[model samples]
Target chain A: MRRTAPITILALTCTLLISMACAVALGPASISPGSLVTLPNAWMIIWDVRLPRVIAAALVGCALAVAGTAMQGLFRNSMADPYIIGTSSGGALGATLSIVLFAGTGRPVFAFAGAAIATFAVYIIARQGGKIPVETLLLSGVALSMLLSAFLSFLMYTAGRSLHQIMFWLMGGFWNVSWDDVIVAILIPVGCLIIYLYARDINIISLGEEDAIHLGVNVERLKQILLFVSAFLTGIAVSIAGAIGFIGLITPHVMRLIVGPDHRVLFPAAALAGGILLLWSDTLTRTFANDMPVGIITACFGAPFFIYLLRSRMKA
Target chain B: MKPVEVIGIDVSYGAKKVLEAISLHVERGEILGIIGPNGAGKTTLVKAMSRIVSPENGTVYLNDQNLDSFSFREMAQQVAVVPQGISISFDYTVRDIVMMGRHPYIERLSSGTSRDLEICDRAMQLANVTHLAGSSVNAISGGERQRALIARALAQEPKILLLDEATSNLDISHRIEILNIIRSLTGKITVISVFHDLNLAAYYCDRLIMLKDRRVYAVGPPEDILTTETIRAVFGIDTFIRHHPFTMRPYVLPVYESPAALGSARRVHVVCGGGTGSDLLYALHREGFQVSAGVLNIFDTDYATAAALKIPCVTEAPFAAISPGARKDLGRCIDATSAVVVTAMPIGQGNIENLRILEDFQDKPVILLGDGGNPSFQDCTGGEADAIVRGLLDRGAVTAERIEEVLRVLHGAA
Candidate 1:
């Protein structure tokens, strides 16, 4: 392990804690520390409005980043993320269906079911003679994502009144988050813990499947577990925050550069850093941009960083 | 029981058959080598043993237990395979990769213990990668990376080690270094390796299994298996097999002459003795010349070469003077050939008649093969051999340096 890994993780943890505190205090009606002590309205705003929203954003961000890190290692491709294989589109479609048909009741359950089904479908489609080759898995993911997005577009066209709500949810924000959402986000850490147990296996498997087999990894089983868990994490994060873009894509990548590729260090480092990143992005939108969707800011930065990665990979 | 035994195993990838009814066994503590040309299923056989590929027809028994019965972890604890090479996607330190070998032992809930660390260190030392333990696998050389892989396999502390041409990608010195390391592990770890280099296989392996068309063509000690005929039949190449001077192992020297390049089919007689004529005989024989050699003793190296090439040679008893009978055979050879080539061999009383008889063929196109600067004949017959050589030179015998020059002169005569 790099000597700086623990230090980086500690620093990210501190940064995440500080960022959450600042986010909770600095939204639209900025409440100073003194006002927090004296004003009942400030206390109500902090407890009922900003606190749950900020905490859910951080938790959802952690879930996405951890899932992204797992996906990248599982596929042995640095470009892989939870959404690259249709999880987000599946969740989005499910969420859209809920919005159009039942006015967003049971949206999280629908989104998770959609995400899990889509991931397994991709896995099954990509399997050839009992092995899931990464290239085929990736292609199957893209194909399924396009089909799910077409379904999502059709649902949006039919929903006349809930169209505005669907568009806002698709853009993705934390304005509607509450304590109940935070309770659901608690499952994120449990999922992260499960993935962390396989960090060493992931390290071995990233070398290649054949090498992994030689090293005693039950490669097919490990692939299934990682895919299912990552999809679970991404599904929960999408259900909670409406598919926040690039927290999953960009955070794991940037943290990998800092902490190196040992998933033991990378998973936690990316989790904290991702939480910090989305926490700050949500804070920026709600405090300064008049509650605009945080996904816009994330995508504005994420797409370019992704493009840079592609160009640099080409050069390499 | 044998350490590894495959019984009537037929392996295939999808619908394409790779190994057909192949069976072999490795005794405990033997470094068994699998050798074959490309597409011979050597690697696939290794895969079958490691349980990477299951055989379609029969069973593999490891320590008399069914290979299918072993869990993946149990199998890894028993066997470790060092691949030809691996391209790691991450920049894992050499230590991290080595430590991963301890994965099968380390429980999923616990990190590697201090005992595991000690094993990893020892493995690195054995593989001579201790100094590179902290270097990124990608930053190191190919040879170092392969050593790290060896270290990783060693860290598994396996009872059986499998190498799939693991050293094939390295240079000669690295290959020797790695093989020596592996050789040092023989009595403790049973090894089954795939070899592309026949010389390395002959030198290092305790026994070799030669494969052809996805079947075991031959299996025996190197001395028995690496014969010119077996190699020619299996690899379709002409090889000169001889004992290595230092190791006494059978050394294979490939006769790389392309038969199509010089297929003169003209008759040539080589008059040589000692070991000097072996290369010339091989060259002439490979080029499709109807070559005959000697008045050589039965024990002469040239006689052996001639025998190996299936050339018609006139041979006498070892250490005996050229008799009247052998001289008659030599005369017949000289008369049947269009050109006669005499190599730079030591002349002695026993073989002096080989030179004196050449004097009778004065009209024949004679090429004296010599190393340009030196006297071709080691004239231990004193002035007698020198006088005969001078007489042959006077009668228009052309001295050509090197075998190619001799072949050019003979071709010109043709």
Candidate 2:
């Protein structure tokens, strides 16, 4: 268990690094070797535009995956994802309102607040008596996600002027990612580190709440901290990448199958794999069809993958 | 010294009260067993002791300090619990699961040290799961899983270990295996376990606390707490209690129900002695006959069985001759019952009066079990007891070769 993780993380980091280099060099109007030797234009585009977008995608991916891992641990369900329980839609709704009202200055703050509130709302509604059964929480999240998404759709329909910006944001892309965005998005790794600090507790919590408590975890406080951190991660990711789907849901699951459920190993591996997965999807969409949203590619793949997971888990 | 003390704790789920005003104390390093029928709050009481559920009105003290004052880590370091059933979806290895018991001691962000791993290794060896350490916990059988959970608790090395039906899912051998593991830990760590099997609880637990209707029904050594009266009262079943010859512990055997009910109105009197009449009484009771037994010596095994079944019995003082007042009571019982059955008890000087009562019941339906040996074989009065039994058999008494035939004769008379 000890030796397996560092090697896996090292391998993933190397793959992520290699993927980033290839991705940065291969956008629309690919930088030629001769141009790389001759002019500052290629250098400027690679440093300014491509690096920030890749870095944004990587950060958002890492954040979403870590948040998804935390949420899965919190709910103790294998199929739990960030967006499955309405966190993404909540963040989107908050950002959309900010885009229209505060003109995007408070988008990150509002998005974080919105995601946190939605998570708690679903949690509060699902809790019966004293226990929140996994099935009840899953159903409640699905219902609330639909309800919130419907409200978001209504808001988008009414906003005639900001429809394009809302559509682009909702489609989920890193087209306008800037240094300020990167600074706000740095919370993804910082939040992941905080989650890592509680990784052992989360591992026990994933077994069951009663098991966690009897094992010496203050379950209520651990839950609050994990939920807050995960929601904060989704909020920050949504502020930059606009509800990129599936990296959070699939990354941890894939890592768990490979590395097992030891959170000490699972969390870091998930973060790296998530970064690589999103960076690959972002590079593919930009290279093949520059106008296409990264969310489209992710959802196109994620929805089917999620259905497969649901079906297989049901059979299990 | 008391390691755990529960004081008037009340626990309820929502509006339904599971346990009310329950109190108990556990001596250090003693194996205390908790037993009750379904829905009797056995699990709730254990939870309260471990501080998993805070009581609405009472407090739990650990080593004379309030349980609420301890942080979760400190509480876990002192008390380890192996819950009834745990389902794991995330495929954690058995070693990974067992290592979780060391969570309270290991600081955050740092894995277990060499000493912690050594303790975990020894714990696995103690639980006999060292071979299964690397296997997925979900892939094992129920008994293996139970052992793994026990190994986890052992890894914790707490002062107290609480088990809630920990062996319920296991098979007979595994049940004994887990119980034996607990039995070995008796003097080293305090154990409070809930057992559904009364026999196992009686065998393994040093002290047993029987619960009924959300209250402490009885609490003492297993021999005292596991009496026939307590079993019948708490479990609502007729059970015979006997001392295990090897361990000297009380063992309970439930009286099996009869094949079919003859009629509730048919009443029968049994003339039995020694241990021969106990089975007949159980058979008659199961067949729905209102049964009574008599003139049995106080120390007779049949008398104890009769008492356990709560049958109205006429009794004589042990090793003494039957009194006239007891004989009068036996006469009334004979007049009231529709028929009488006699078991093959050894005829003795003290119980010879029991044979004389047969002469009066010759006109009635008396089912007598015939053993070929004469009553004089056990008689101190020479051939007189044999002659009396022979006369009773000739005077229109029905002969039965087996106890089931006695039940048949009663049903026939009914």
Error of 1 at A54 (Å): 0.3
Output the worst ten-in-a-row residue range by lDDT, candidate 1 chain B: B373-382
Q: Which CAPRI category fits model 1?
A: high
> How does model 1 fare in lDDT?
0.88
Residue A243 C-alpha lDDT in model 1 = 70
Winner by TM-score: 1
Q: Write the per-residue lDDT of candidate 2 for residues A1-316, one digit (tens) a residue.
A: 7557788889999998998889888899779878977988988888888888888888898999999998888888877777888888889889998988878889999899989999998889888865677688889889998888887888888888998888876779988888788889877888999999999999898888888889999999998998899999999999898888888889998998888788889999999999999998999988898648999999998899989988987797
State the fnat of model 1.
0.79
lDDT of 2 by residue, B354-377 (tens): 778778765777777756422223
TM accuracy, model 2: 0.89
lDDT value, residue B125 of candidate 2: 93
Clash pairs, candidate 2, are: none
In CAPRI terms, where does candidate 2 land?
A: medium
CA displacement after TM-score superposition, residue B3 of candidate 2 (Å): 1.5
Model 1, residue B256: distance off in Å is 1.5
Question: After superposing the true interface residues, what Cα RMSD does each candidate give?
Answer: 0.8, 0.8
